[model samples]
Target: MQDRFLADVLANRHNRAILERWDDLALPDAWLVAGCLFQTVWNLQSGRPPEADIKDYDLFYFDAGDLSEAGERAVQARVDALLGDLGVCIEASNQARVHLWYESYFGHPYAPLHSSRHGIERFLVPSTCVGVRPGEVCAPYGLALLYDGVLGMNPLVPHRDLFERKAASYRARWPWLRMAADAATPHPAA
Candidate 1:
């Protein structure tokens, strides 16, 4: 099932374009992650347009060698220049520096991460926890939840309030989506 979804995502012109540009940039441990990857699949599952209601394209990379805010901004500027024509917001964040400002920004204590994938693992929802690199999709939380159309929580760092709020937003857009019982609890298979 994941393979099928991966093929579909790879076939998408928007995704392919983004992936190509991301590859061209060649950022260290870079990935086209989050909504832009999984939401396309959700739209497919619900028979909606592939790019419908996607908020942004998240590009994450780990550059521990230069964990300064200016360093991340420089990379972000480069990304903006590369993907500015896409007509969608492209958010680039350095995983190495997330812990420095995460608490101030989100009111939570985010532990220092080792790599880009470590940051992916802390996503609020299981379905949104997927990332795409040059040739593969990485889902540390497993793809079964996404394959079964179940919205599960990351037991490692469950943020129930944010999950419910985001679920409401998603439900409003994709009415077919079902919410889990609680933030810390994984939903039953669909």
Candidate 2:
């Protein structure tokens, strides 16, 4: 078995079937609440025959809304039902929305976001570049499953410079939630 095969398996039609079934309902257009939309599923196709049938599934989602509890819970329920139907042996906590287990063919951990109380912050991944610097990329932002919705960085927000500048003044005012990243303007994604 090759990694290509595993990856292919994850990308196979069956996975799509499952996702489609999950989508039968009106699920928010994001996965994990905030990070990146479900770009593509990651297959666990390693070069091992014993694990050929086993492929890991990776789903992504990002914050596109300002803040909404109803939206987060709706998304979380859909994900939970899908994973349950797949018979995934997941370890989930109501206190924390992080779920990880080993029942699927691939032993990849799945995070079922419930909500974030304090909300989350976004950062650059330090890998991709969208402008002048070819080697520069946005850092990985932080996400928390608190409140009745997922709270994380808003990727679609204003430019970093404007955001950083606007957020800087609050740092001295609010010590607990310091704005360590560059200051940017405060504008909600439309």
For candidate 2, the 10 contiguous residues with the lowest summed lDDT are 125-134
The TM-score of candidate 1 is 0.89
Residues 2-106, candidate 1: write the lDDT tens digits: 678687677556788888776578799888898887888878888877888877888899999998999999998998898889888888999999999988987
Q: Write the per-residue lDDT of candidate 2 for residues 97-173, one digit (tens) a residue.
A: 23322115233333433432212222111111001011111113211111112212235332455445434532333
Candidate 2 off by > 4 Å: 1-14, 31-45, 49-58, 61-71, 89-190
lDDT of 1: 0.79
What is the TM-score of each predicted model, taking all chains together?
0.89, 0.29
- Candidate number with greatest lDDT: 1
Badly placed stretches (over 4 Å) of model 1 are: 181-190
For candidate 2, give the lDDT of residue 103: 16
